[model samples]
Target: MYEKLVELQSSTHEEATQQMVADEEDRRRGLEAAKLQLAEMEEKRNVSLLTPFLKVAIVETNSPAFEAGLRSGYQILQFGTVTSTVLASQGPSALMSATAEGVLLPVWVREEDQGEPRKILVVPHRWEGKGLLGCSFDPIRAK
Candidate 1:
């Protein structure tokens, strides 16, 4: 009879241990979900205005945008326009300004797997040194 009691106690202990493991797993999953949520929010908040053909490569450490986040593989899919409601001190307006001063052409472009329409705009504010930002691009012909 004592053996039967001992067996019952062992089974109860095992079940309790299983329950604790499951609880820990549940807590872990919940924490992971929260982390992903925060990252998504940051990403949505981080993007700037969309542009066409804006070079999407990262600026080098010695380059102009190095003090900026301009990490390798990060792109400038957009420019000039605000990406979100909250504007951060670190943003892309400087790049746009430089481009306006004949630094580069401002245009919209997207990369692979983005799953969005791949085009943006650049307002034609006539700056002395800048090239054209018009929609119409044409091929040059030999004379």
Candidate 2:
């Protein structure tokens, strides 16, 4: 009877160990799936961030905008905190309001040749040109 009891306990322990291993494998697979999903979501968000909202209509020579490497035909993805959503409700004034004198504002832009988006730091201080940026922007119409 003692030997029988020992055998039963050993069998029970083996079964429990196997179940635990299987559960661990399932958990690992679930974690991997969640990671893949999160990566996909991040990729989509990055792509959206690169979408252009406004195009640089003109950039004056020797101006703050030109000094910052802004060029005509470059599409503006984001200017400071101004995005397409803000432009939709607030117009171009939202972008102007985001700028401040002597402050370097980050602007995301894409070239007209469909290149990858790039970031440029622009200061809004007075320049030799008309506007603070010495550049003009035009809204990109949706197709």
Candidate 3:
């Protein structure tokens, strides 16, 4: 009877240890999933912060802006570091200063027909036309 009791206690201890390990694994996986979900939420919030402040008035054919997939009626959400707030305070100079020759600038734009915004890299380089971008932009005035 004494030997049997020791054997039962040993078996119970082993089972408890295995259960603890399984619970810990499940907890680790849940933590990882929560972290991923938080990251995705932060990304969406950052993208939402960029509001459309300018609209593309013209995009010359074969130009840098045109080649970068910019088109007329597309709204410019963020040009390099120029966001909606910056555009309101500093105006077009902020955007013009951002476009350095031979440098690739990240531009976030929203299409007129689409609800989501897209990112496009525009390289400011001299083309056959006048300006570096060969595109004209108009400010989106508040209603």
Superposed Cα deviation of residue 90, candidate 2 (Å) = 2.4
Backbone collision tally, model 3: 0
Q: List ranges where model 3 is wrong by over 4 Å.
A: 1-45
Clashes of each: 10, 0, 0
Against the hidden true structure, what lDDT does model 2 obtain?
Answer: 0.85
Name the best candidate (by lDDT). Answer: 3
| Candidate 1 pairs with clashing backbones | 49-78, 50-78, 51-78, 51-107, 51-108, 52-107, 52-108, 53-107, 53-108, 53-109
lDDT of 2 at 52: 78
Using TM-score, give the best candidate's number: 3
Candidate 3 local accuracy as lDDT?
Answer: 0.88
Please write out the lDDT profile of model 2 over residues 67-103, one tens digit for every residue: 9999999998888888787888998789768999899
Estimate, for each residue in 1-143, the C-alpha lDDT of model 1 and write its tens digit.
Answer: 99999999999999999999999999999999999999856644444233333334433333333322333333344454432221234444544353553343333334433534333333443433323332222111222
> Which has the higher lDDT value, candidate number 1 or candidate number 3?
3
lDDT string for model 3 (14-101, tens) is 9999999999999999999999999967754686567788899999999999999999999988888899898789977998889999
